[model samples]
Target: MSADRATTETAGLMDRMYRHQRHIYDASRKFYLLGRDQLIAELDPPPAGSILEIGCGTGRNLIKLARTYPDTQCYGLDVSAEMLATAGRSVARSGLSERIHLAQADATCFDAAALFGRDGFDRIVISYALSMIPPWRGVIAQALRTLTATGSLHIVDFGDQRGLPASFRVLLNRWLTLFHVTPRHDLPEAIAELSRIEGAESRTRRLLRGYAIHAVATRRAA
Candidate 1:
């Protein structure tokens, strides 16, 4: 399929999946979607810098980032209109409409400058979104292109459950399949390769016995 067609289809699928799920997403996801808050805690954007979240579902993480770093501006992009609608309402409810900006765009291929009137961001985050995106590597590369020279990209997502019980891993994978989420077992190696090619520094941490993975890739100096 063409890129646009694929994006549209994915967006439709996500909307159908989250049309109702977005309402209670944050409340229920708090259980299994681990390491997200930790990733937010590690986000140290530059003073008055800009932060962007690639798949800012329901604007949950973006709201947290804005409240945590009041000095920084926050931007979010999600392919699903249904989710963005919920996110918009959440941002408005938080009275952060002035500081947080959101747009509907495919994470794998978005024009940041055109969408948000910015060239790059100081800190970019992808929290648990990679597991659902079909072209996750492309999304990571696109995020790298949207980073400032000194910026860092942070990611937290489902892991391979290597340290967990075999039965648990099987059950977890089955549960995740219902949401169309697939743990990218090669994520660490992919990040390493991308960082190497871009002259960036990369780090990975396994959490909760490989139930989740956290990664950071900082761009190199020119």
Candidate 2:
């Protein structure tokens, strides 16, 4: 499929999947979505910095991050209009609508300047969304393009679970499939190669016996 067509289908699938799930996504996933709060706590943005979340579903993370760092500006994009609608209401309820901006766009090829009127951001995060995005590597590349010289990118997602019991891994993957999630086993090597080519550096840490992975990559000054 052409890029545009693929994006359209991705959006459709996301909307269909989250139309109702968005309401209970947080409560249900909190048990398995490990390392999210740790990633947010470590996102130490620069003074008055700008932060963006590529797939900011339900605006949960964005809202928490905003409250964590009141001096920063927050922006988010998600392909699902259904999720964005829920996110908007959540943000308004948190009384953070003024500090948070939301937009509907595909994460794989978004134009930051056009969407948020900024060339780049000081911090960017992707929280457990990569496994659901078919073109996850493309989304990572596009997100890197919006990183300022000193900016950093953070990602936390399902890991290979190699350190866990074989039976557990099997059951986890099987259950995750219901949500269209496929853990990217090669995430470490992929980001290492991407960072090398981009003149950046990255490191990933496995959490909970590889149940989740967290990465932090920083680009050198130009």
Candidate 3:
């Protein structure tokens, strides 16, 4: 299928899935969605720089980012209209509508210039979204392409759970399947390969007994 059609279909599916779930997403996800706040804290955007979050569900991270880095501009893109609606409301409630902009687009193939009137971002974050995207590698490549020189891309997602108990891993995998989420066991390898090809600096850490992985890749100096 064409990229547009695929994006539309994926958007529809996400909207259907989160039409109501968006309400309690943050509250419930707080338990297992580890390292998100760490990722946010580590995001030290340059003064007056721009930041974007792919698959910014409910705008929770964007709101925090706006509050934490008052000088930086924040933007977000999500395929789900339903989630965006919730995110918009959240941003407005947080009184950050002026600093935070949001749009609906596929993370794998979005035009940052058209959506946010910029060709690149100083900081881009993908939090727990890659595992759910079918074309996650494409998303990584796109993010790298849109990263400004000296910019960084941050990612946090489910790990292989190698350190977790076997029974727990089995149960978690089964639960994730219901939500259409898959842990990318090869994520570290993918990051290394991409960083090598793009001539960027890459770092990754496995946290919570290998339950989650956090990664950062910075653009190479020109």
Candidate 4:
């Protein structure tokens, strides 16, 4: 399928899956989506900088980001219109419509310049999203290209569960599969390769004994 068609189909699928789930997504996900708060805390975007979140379901992270970094501009994009609708309402309810801008776009093909009138972002965050996306590597490349010269990319997602018990891993994977999530086993290597190709420095940490992977890649492009 073509990229546009694939994006459209994926959006439809997500909308169907989260049409009702979006209402309680943040609340339910808070329990198992570990390392998200850590990623947000470590963002440390520069003063008056810009932060963008890909696959920003329900705009939960964007709202938190705006509150955390009041001096910065925050933006988010999610393919599912249903999720964006909830996100829009949530942002407005929080009185952050001005500070938090949102759009409906696919992470793999979104244009930051077109969506947010910005060429690049100072900080890009992806929290627990890669596992649910099939073309996750492409999303990483797209995010790197959307980063400013001195920008950084932060990511947190389900890890390989190497440190956890084998039975636990099996059970967890089964549970995750029910939600269309598949942990990226080669996440660290993928980040290293992409960051190197983009002239960035990348580091990854295995958190919760490999239950989650937290990665940060900083660019020093001239």
Question: lDDT tens string, model 2, 1-222?
Answer: 798898889899999999899989999989999999999999999999999998999999999999999999999999999999999999999999999999999898888889989999999999999999987998888878789889999999999898999999999999999999999999999888888877778999999999999998899887
TM-score of each: 0.98, 0.98, 0.98, 0.98
Task: Quote model 2's TM-score.
Answer: 0.98
Cα miss at 20, model 4 (Å)?
1.0
On residues 31-128, what C-alpha lDDT tens digit does candidate 1 reach at each position? Answer: 99999999999898999999999999999999999999999999999999999999999999999999999999999889999999999999999999
State the TM-score for model 1. 0.98
Better of 1 and 3 by lDDT: 1
Ranked by lDDT from best down, the candidates are 1, 3, 4, 2
lDDT of 4: 0.93
Predictions: Cα RMSD each: 0.7, 0.8, 0.8, 0.8
The local distance difference test score of each candidate is 0.95, 0.93, 0.94, 0.93
lDDT of 2 at 191: 86
Pick the winner on lDDT between candidates 1 and 2. 1
Quote the lDDT for 158 in model 1.
95
Q: How big is the positional error of residue 174 in model 4, measured in Å on the Cα after superposition?
A: 0.6
The residue-by-residue lDDT of candidate 3 on 1-222, one tens digit each, is 998899899998999999989999999999989999999999999999999999999999999999999999999999999999999999999999999999999898899999999999999999999999999999898898889988999999999899999999999999999999999999999988888787788999999999999999999888
Give model 1 RMSD, 1 decimal: 0.7
Off by over 4 Å in 3: none
Off by over 4 Å in 2: none
